[model samples]
Target: MSAPTEPSRTSDAPGRGPDPRAERSRAAALAAARDLLIEQGWSAVTHVAVAARSGVGRTTLYRHWPDASGLVRDVIAERISTAHTPPTGVLRDDLIRELDGLRRLLHDPVSDRGLRAVIERAGVDPVFARLKEALYREGSRVFRTVLDAAKARGELAADLDPDLAVDQLAGPLMYRRLLAGRAVTAEYVERVVDDFLAAHAPT
Candidate 1:
């Protein structure tokens, strides 16, 4: 008789706890894909090569991600979803806090570099552009919500267009980040908040 056969490994197996090894492999694959995108642009990223770089198997990667674009979408969402919502007390205070958060994010080397690369890639890739637009829309909605709250509280000019106001408030920060590559310092945030409030406050 043949020797007793070992149980086949599967997603549901007795005595098998959560697969920490597989989790690490997936994380490594995502990290490798992100690093490759940052270093070599999206055109050079490949699932097989990402697995090799990540020390994972091609089958493992394919098991986790249906395609390279899907993997990239996950990576982008993971990286960019860290944006925090500003508090909702006062309009000026909220804007100041939001700008401070922006400053912190802008100064982070990995995030800053990744954002610039993604933004540049968005110009050429429609999918990336759509992702960027979605991110912007979400952020804009948060700011508009805060502004609407402020309006209800009689803190802002009654006739202020929330969308346009958000644009004015955030445009300078984006310009500095994307064009000048300047650090978003506390003083910079304070100055912008002051200028914005002065211009938009109820008279």
Candidate 2:
């Protein structure tokens, strides 16, 4: 005899709240908010706009995110991990890999514009400024983790400050993007990685 067919899985299972449909709606709204922010800056992100772009009702977007800044904050927070890279054995290789990951993130048109928009808004909005500060900290986590691994592998001094090292590595990229208006290409990332490692490598 043939075996009985298994029950189909769905969002409507008993005792399961808000199911897959709700989750998909929420994700769609977030994606729409991100795209809007990238395409038109922070000013473009609103309840009505996100609702229209996401194909959900304004009430639903408003229910989950009361303010546009809250939605923007969530988007940026979720994207902080996009540039993360796992540790490699060699310190230089690890640093280069991390920088390369960053370069890819910056090269992504959506992320590039989204980041610039937030930075511009942060200059004038205190709420956005706070979120930006938190974002910077979150964005630095991967670098710190890589630094810790380098130290463990005897490639960096035990007393080398992880925060300072991360600043050294990321500062130039930000300067080029925000101040100098230079393209952060793979070559630029390699140079930044090399210069930082030359100065910080364990003696």
Candidate 3:
């Protein structure tokens, strides 16, 4: 008779966790993908290119991502979702804190390039369009969280739309910093916060 079969090995099995080497490879591949995305545009990040740059085997990448979209999606998510500020219970202050974070991020040349690539590619590339949809869904989570808290505390109208608020708060910053190539100064941030508060004053 055949020998008793052993249970299939799984990462979730007791004492069986992610391999350090695999994790390192994944991090390296993501770094490579981010660099390629920013430096060479969205079309440059293929499995072969990423494997060549990251020194990770193509088979490994394919096993994990299955296609370039998976890899590119993750890189874009990381690019946009880098920071999250905890709420201070004051709506004005919270908005300022979040906008300031955006100001600083947009000011960085590397981040600026990445954001431009994402916007540009997402406009033209169908693959990036899908990724962009998924990204924008959750990218403003921190800002939404802050608004929800304000509504709960009677600091904002219950009927206010958080999605519109996100656009209102971030649209100016992007138009100025990215499109107009202007500096995002403290005064500009203040003006933005003031306008938003005026528009949506607490009941």
Candidate 4:
């Protein structure tokens, strides 16, 4: 009889945690994909191009992402799911900080281009539209959390709607930047933050 066979190795097997080197390679590929998307549009992102830019092998990228859309979904999801809200204790200050970050992002050439590409693609592609919707919902959670905290602390009305509030705060900046082709100046960002707080914050 053959010697007792060992258990098949699987990702969930003991001592089989993810490889750090593979993680680094994945990070590099993601970074390269993000840069290429921003600089040359989504059309420029391919397994070979990402591998070339990231210094990883094309096969490695293919094993992970399978296709360009898979990579795009991840890149967009990574950006849209997390919003940084500085904890200042003061709701107004926090809103200002968040909006100020948005202002700066809109002003960045790379970020601006990437954002525009996502928006434009979403308009015409159902797949991208779904991804965009997911992003929007996730992004809304940031403002929702802030609003909930403010409500709990008696800084905002208990009935304040977070979704509507976020739209009011973020919609103008995006519209002005993408549709109106106008710069979201620092002053403009401050005004929106102030206006939203004035209208919604508890007296």
Q: Estimate each model's TM-score.
A: 0.78, 0.76, 0.72, 0.71
Better of 1 and 3 by TM-score: 1
Best by lDDT: 3
Q: Which residue pairs in candidate 3 have backbone atoms (N, alpha carbon, C) closer than 3 angstroms, thus clashing? A: none
TM-score of candidate 4 on Cα atoms, chains taken together:
0.71
Cα lDDT tens digits, model 1, 47-76, are 877987998888877766756765675566
Minimum summed lDDT over a 10-residue window in model 1 is located at 1-10
| Predicted structure 2, TM vs. truth | 0.76
Global lDDT of each candidate: 0.71, 0.74, 0.76, 0.73
Candidate 4's residue-wise lDDT over 75-166, tens digit each?
Answer: 65555434576567778777777777777777776557656767888887775787667656655655777778899998887788887899
Of the two candidates 2 and 3, the one with more favorable TM-score, higher being better, is 2
Q: Each model's number of backbone clashes?
A: 0, 0, 0, 0
Q: Rank the candidates by TM-score, best first.
A: 1, 2, 3, 4
What is candidate 2's lDDT per residue for 1-203, written digit by digit as tens?
11111111233468775566767877898899889878887778899899889997887677677677777766666665555656666777777787777677676666676678678888887767876676677677777887888888887877898888988888888778767877888788888888887787778
On a 0 to 100 scale, what is the lDDT of residue 117 in model 2? 67
Off by over 4 Å in 1: 1-18, 83-88, 121-126
Model 1 clash number: 0
Candidate number with the higher lDDT (1 or 4)? 4
